[model samples]
Target: MKPRFTALLTLLVVALLGGCASQPPLRQAKDVDLARYMGTWYVIGHVPYFAEKGDVATADEYRLKPDGDIAVTYHYRKGFDAPEKTWAGKAWLPDPADTAHWKVQLVWPLRSDYVIVDLAPDYRSVLIGLPSRKLMWIMARERQLPAAEYQRLLAVAKAEGFPVDQVRKVPQRCEDLGQAGFEQP
Candidate 1:
């Protein structure tokens, strides 16, 4: 009994210390203009969740609802030649004052964090992140970001404590453009 208690206490101490050493609270971009943010944003870079494996030419379309919830349609192709597919979800602000932090529900019951970590002044580009920076999406108005802008976003993500090395460049082809759901008039 004495040995077991000693071992358990040692583990507890290590856990507490580890928590203290963990990364600081993630910083988010302030004052997001929701209307300006609504549109089709092409995914140029991402730290994909398992479901996104082999995804190509990915994009997300957001439509602001009267009740302030965002209707999201995620479009992607499994491969370069595969047909485009879509998934739907909704995102809502947990605190009305904090527009940058959203609780996105992609499936029933479970909600995930969606933080606007960075956004271009022109609204042409943006970066959204999940908790622990384990997932992130670098999106822009076009299929790909310019080299300079991409590098700038990479630096911003790194400064924000994301694992930059884990980011995968999402493939986008000009031929994939103008798909019905991915393109908005």
Candidate 2:
């Protein structure tokens, strides 16, 4: 093989490998108040999922069940004729440094990644983060929040280095399939 050709091939390989790597900064919330974080949250936006975008006007509600397990309610309206779909799960704090961090095991005992990445000053809104930062969610306590508030959270996310373009408005009702999930308090 010619030396020039070998050099070009090596550069191409390096570029391809670098492109395949994931980029997510390692940062956790500094102060998390679990109690204030609990409540029903409507999914305003989230990272896109290629497989299934089946829920719209999605909301997640959390409360301590009488049995001591954190009860989670995943609700979404599919369409006008389709009734809302609800999935329940249990979550528990696995780390002490940040009680906001929890592991949620659904019906199959499979744990979905969960992290508290953004919050409002008074704890009225929140953003959930996945380990890779590729998956993120913007949530509000009410189904409808002020436009200014939503934009404010978007700015915070951009400042934190999230891919803002990937964020899109989630449907308000199952009339359209939107994505949503619960964030443990």
Q: Best TM-score goes to which candidate?
A: 1
| Candidate 2 lDDT (Cα, 0 to 1) | 0.64
lDDT of 1 by residue, 1-185 (tens): 34334334433433333234357767888899889989899998876544666678889999999999999888987677778888787989999899898877655545667789899999999988765666678899998789799889989999987888878777787564454323221
The candidate 2 region of ten consecutive residues with least summed lDDT is: 176-185
* Clashes within 3 Å, all models in order: 0, 8
TM-score of each candidate structure, all chains considered together: 0.80, 0.72
lDDT of 2 by residue, 47-86 (tens): 6553115456688888865654577878765444667767
- As a TM-score, model 1 comes out at 0.80
TM-score, candidate number 2:
0.72
Model 1 spans with C-alpha error above 4 angstroms: 1-22, 174-185
At residue 163, what lDDT does model 1 achieve?
A: 80
Off by over 4 Å in 2: 1-26, 50-52, 66-68, 173-185
